[model samples]
Target chain A: MTTIDYRLIDSTLRDGSHAISHQYYAEDVIRIVKGLDAAGVQVIEIAHGDGLGGSSFNYGFSAVPEKELIAAACDVTDQAKIACLLLPGIGIVDDLREVGALGVKVARIATHCTEADISEQHIKAAKELGMEAIGFLMMAHMNSPEGLVEQALLMQSYGADTLYIADSAGAMTTEDVRRRVNALVSALEIPVGVHAHNNLSMAVANSIAAYEEGAVNLDGTSAGLGAGAGNCPTEILAAVSTKYGINTGVDPLKLMDLAEEIVRPMMPRQQVIDRAGLILGYAGVYGSFLLHSQRAAERYGVSQAEILLELGRRKVVGGQEDMIIDVALELARKHAEQEV
Target chain B: MRCAIIGSGNIGTDLMIKMLRSEVLELVALVGIDPQSDGLARARSLGVQGPHEGPQWVLDHASEIDMIFDATSAYVHVRHYKQYAEAGIVAVDLTPAARGPKVIAAVNLEEHLNSPNINMVTCGGQATTPMVYAVRRAIETLPYAEMVSTIASKSAGPGTRQNIDEFTKTTSQALREIGGAETSKAIIVLNPAEPPIMMRNTVFAALPEGSDHSAVIESIYAMEKTVQSYVPGYHLKNRPVIEAGPFKTPGGDVPHRAVVLLEVEGAGDYLPAYAGNLDIMTAAAMKVGEAVAASRVSEARL
Candidate 1:
């Protein structure tokens, strides 16, 4: 049987921070980094869920400064390279420099799918810092495949070595992932990657579809610990890739034990396809909005589903988490009017 | 007063159009490095000189021009402001270069009119700083203030993208130094909505215990009217919201929080009406430029 080859970038510490409300401590980071390193994962990404400079009331404060966690991850990893995510507007070039000094080798510079032009400076800066710059297009479901190619070409021209289409909302169906990945893989000279979320329970299938469409890179998190329902589970993907003869260079049994022994105990709640999480995928809302929307819903005495649906109707993108409170308050006002 | 505009991008072109309608400021030329720029083309069609020699064109014509509007990027503005000052010309900067005193048209324009150079902090600063200042005016202490400005991605040109860091830093500083907050933070979001949303801002301020909510609201409403006098499209989206809280901020917790939501729609001069982010910067800079020009006219008379 012919083997399908790919590099796996695990984002449990970065994207998974959203599920825990940006509260990952140094010990948790060190434990997870050592576990993942031993499991043969190629890369491990660590940062605030909203990226660097994300510790504030807006995105929620990190329990420990992300730099401390980045240093811990850097210190723990052996075979795996350390990566960090930075949204240009939220995290600046200085943030990149600081993380780079702590041994961050990969810089994933993310922006809204239609706004890749903004990633030019950050991507160039990462390259200048001698980091492997990955241009990440978040909310890939928001734009057409051709539209994504146009934006991806801008990042490619800006010196990004790799490009990724992130289903930040967990909204894309397998076909949607295929079309976007195929278009990017076809148009770009650099390798393409896919970061998936399991809100729709389609993260694994979509990631496999992305690989079939010629994506050489794929992303996952241990035990599916990430925003919304969660990301594609690292252990599950490794196991599935093994069964399919796809060489992901990861030890499936080691990841499974790491997930069960180390990561699951630290999670606030087990990642599940609950109502709010499901709505994130169904309504095409950002995955990180799940926790924020739930908090606003409880505070305002409104339904989390209603808040998620309304946010979807408004078409709010990532970085607009503050809109959750605005939507919940408006819905509460409407419900009060109805009761009157 | 005779004046010229440098950097004929979307902001520069929009400022040129707005300045053409001003009673005090005369539209002399639109300067840029590209001869085929749409701003220069529009300037030529409108019977104003459109030169392709960059800032040098403005300096060469300094004898006739009294004030110059520098609508270029932050780096370009930083390089040219000293030259403009040496030429005895008053420069109104629209970039976040912060080479001079930051001037918000409604808050502190008159104070800096005589200054050799005035900086319009940022579109976000112009939109939300007034709200922060209003709260500070009503309450004795504003410990923490944070603002989030979300605009259509289509409206954010290359200049805005490159200066994203400067935008946040300058806007945050404006909230404290100008809006009277002890500490402040700024966040910007570029929304890629298809029908293109208007520029929207949310300002959050934490006040001490026993602060007066009604006085804060009254102060904010009055400030809204003052800003509206110059930016006709600016207005509050809802009544000012005051919530009881030990709202967590980087500075510390506070007893009360004030929330203000604002929407800005452009006048459709050069860009679409949805591009209020660009509109506010150009409009506020025009207000500062006119006040400076009128003040200079009266100064010459004196």
Candidate 2:
């Protein structure tokens, strides 16, 4: 009800980087950005390799430099809203501010739910610069309706232009999405969006659920190239949105073109979605990218469930690959020992 | 006796699967407020436990189990902690909501688990706290403990999103708990960048004047670097040995460019990043281990 424009943010460059290593030979990125823009995608986000702050490679896996990625994104100026994803503590106050300075119109600053207090300063800064700031409450996996409301009110206080309820696990079902998004909209004066994963193949359905419940913004990656059973495929959302007359501004056919053209051949070798990432969709884990765990599985020689368990045991936050592998390896060793 | 795991979420399923494979813990029931929780279905399919629809179902079978592992989210943990405690049923909270003793297997964990509510800190806290204590004690000359930051790859899971804020706060709490230093801050970074990121923490403990410079630096670096194997790079920031750690690319999609630069601002000098990380993580993991063991064994709840 708050944001009737119904903006669709294509995080392929941002969150999709979770799958592509934030590197796509430079040209592939240009193509994807151009294609998505031409397809009427609103935001073509450019995110750093995972572990934006600690090391150029926090996961101890990715190698693209943030500087280079930002530089690459700078090239795509006209087609779409150039955005960057900033994890408050990971990217320094200066780093994010620099991102804002770099002509990025939108800054998606993410923090854990209830940490909206911590995310406040960043959101304020992004606002001061006249940039649209989104307070993303990643992994909105909560059992209590009160906690959900608490997170929304917190996000609202930060003066964020938008608050995204990210189902990083793809855990929430359709009705569940309606309830969660509705709760956030009810709590905050700002607009709320839904980012879903298709682990349980409900990314399309859930995104709509959020829309029907008063959410205006929808986030997805091309071909749903994301973590933990993948994200809601962008083409599907664009198509479904238009059919419902939501005016997402996304050209469904072009979105599909980007998926087939840019995503198909250029993608990395990934682990298949584990049962848990899938169930979390139904069970609702609200994952950002399933590809992260897949890589963990293949590298560690364990199942996706095992990788998820290892991630849980380590309290490995989403997007922390280095710890995920270490946990997976350790867990696999434990399983091996048990076998003996 | 079998242990029931309520809330078959990530941690719940993990505990269930791990318990199923262990001779020490037997699985009996997996309960959730939502029946769709995959872990419940998983437990049932694996014949690992009885997947129940909710707490009411689980309460009925509580008498049949010896222990209950609340692997659900913190809200659920908080809601049921008293019930489990009052039922005379030992409960191990995998989530971060318990009010009882926070157990780190390697820390001051001996008699605390005897208290009904046992809290397990995040993986980062488990992997980093011991080193915080070690560095503080070893370099008794340091002042203003500054946790420059923690950078890790994505793929860790929802528990993090649900608790990253609590994670940072809880981590600093543990650091102070073990290190006895009031000046502590935690910086958590989640990498969604391509080539997924690994977890790395670099502590900047500005050493006291006239302290043994090189030895303190190297030892702390050594300690920190050792734990990088545990997945999270618990090391001295920007040091020599950092290159030596066996960090990885999550499977193959993500690259492993985890370079932590640890600059110890103004005291005498900052230790190398690698060395500092090693010391902190090794110490933290050890502390967690100590806490876990004591909590489990002393309480006789394990």
The numbered model that scores best in TM-score is 1
CA lDDT of each prediction against the hidden true structure: 0.91, 0.60
Best by DockQ, which number? Answer: 1
lDDT of 2 by residue, A1-340 (tens): 2333578888776666656655545666778878887887778777653424423233323355554666667677566888777776555456666766677788887765545555766777788888888888776764344676786677677778888877776666687787788777888889888888777777889888888888988988888776656777889888887788777766799889889877867777442455666644544333533454566577657876666654553443454443444555566677788999
What's each prediction's TM-score?
A: 0.96, 0.56
Assess the local accuracy of residue A146 in candidate 2 as a C-alpha lDDT between 0 and 100: 60
Model 1 residue A66 distance off true place after TM-score fit, in angstroms: 1.2
The true-versus-predicted C-alpha distance at residue A98 of model 2, in Å, is 1.6
Native-referenced Cα lDDT, model 2: 0.60
- For each of the candidates, give the backbone clash count: 0, 105
- Stretches off by above 4 angstroms in model 2 are A1-5, A49-57, A60-63, A269-302, A310-316, A319-326, B1-302
iRMS of each prediction: 1.6, 9.6
Deviation in Å, model 1, residue B107 alpha carbon = 2.0
Q: Which numbered prediction scores highest in lDDT against the true structure?
A: 1
